[model samples]
Target: MLAEYRQFVLPRQRGLHAEIIIIPTGELKVNIKEKNNSLKAEFDELYFHSAGKETELVCRDQLGTESVRWHLHLANDDARELAMLIESAEEEFEALMRDL
Candidate 1:
């Protein structure tokens, strides 16, 4: 919606991450959770947006389709704030790791 990203990362598990490319031709979407806990090491899909907090995480349902859980909207300042906090926590985690 704002700009185009060449490559993006998606999650499959608690510590697993998958790299994906955002096709500029289609609508941007992301799948966070796997159905029935059938995930192996990555999420159901990947998304491309948000510098860090300006993003959304979608959880698809209905078994084999692209539904949404955190789809974007006309406004998402609160959501963005939450995401920013998560990112900040991760950064702090990395700092902790370095300290350890």
Candidate 2:
């Protein structure tokens, strides 16, 4: 999971990049934006769980205090497929940020 985080995403230039930490519970966090004088648009307390064939991504925001959840199911684990998934995710995230 840590390897995936490091390989798939780059450092956030304007906001904050996703970071993975190994503590009491493995977690992932990202600072997506800022508001006022406080850290805003940050996602934390992320918990990833895998079912039989799907993975779940759950996260909470620091400022809005909202929770977002998503899931991914992979049919095959191949380099090309993985690349496409990462690229698609990045494009989607970028579009979302632009909309905000």
Candidate 3:
């Protein structure tokens, strides 16, 4: 059988902290830990723009929803991996659109 998608989990330092995952279908699954509550957002849209050492992620769950911006500090390797994932997502989206 052929794999339809790829999945990856972002590495973190440890302990209870926020985590991010790239789903097989290309969406982002993010979990944030708060003082008394945890919040999870499955973003259908992800826009990544990088400048120098700073990377900005614009995420939205759906159309007309308020978008959230996240500024992430990533190592060189991490940044490269993220860029690849974004590219993969875009490619997949385009392919799906063409297929429909």
Highest lDDT: give the candidate number: 3
- The digit string of per-residue lDDT tens for model 2 on 1-100 reads 1123322221223343323222212233233223222111222444344554444444455455665543223222322334444445556666766788
lDDT per residue for candidate 1 within 10-92, as digits (tens), equals: 32234323222222232333323322222211133433254444445444553666764443321145345434444454566
Candidate whose TM-score is highest: 3
Q: What lDDT is obtained when candidate 3 is compared to the true structure?
A: 0.50
Error of 1 at 71 (Å): 7.0
lDDT of 3 by residue, 1-100 (tens): 1112222222332333445556545555555443233233343566566666545555655566775644334444555676676567667777877898
Return the clash pairs for model 3, or none: none
The stretch of ten residues in a row with the least summed lDDT in candidate 3 is 1-10
Clashing pairs in 1: 11-43, 12-42, 12-43
lDDT ranking from best candidate downward = 3, 1, 2
Each prediction's total of clashing residue pairs, residues at least 3 apart in sequence or on different chains, is 3, 0, 0
Candidate 1 weakest lDDT stretch, 10 residues: 34-43
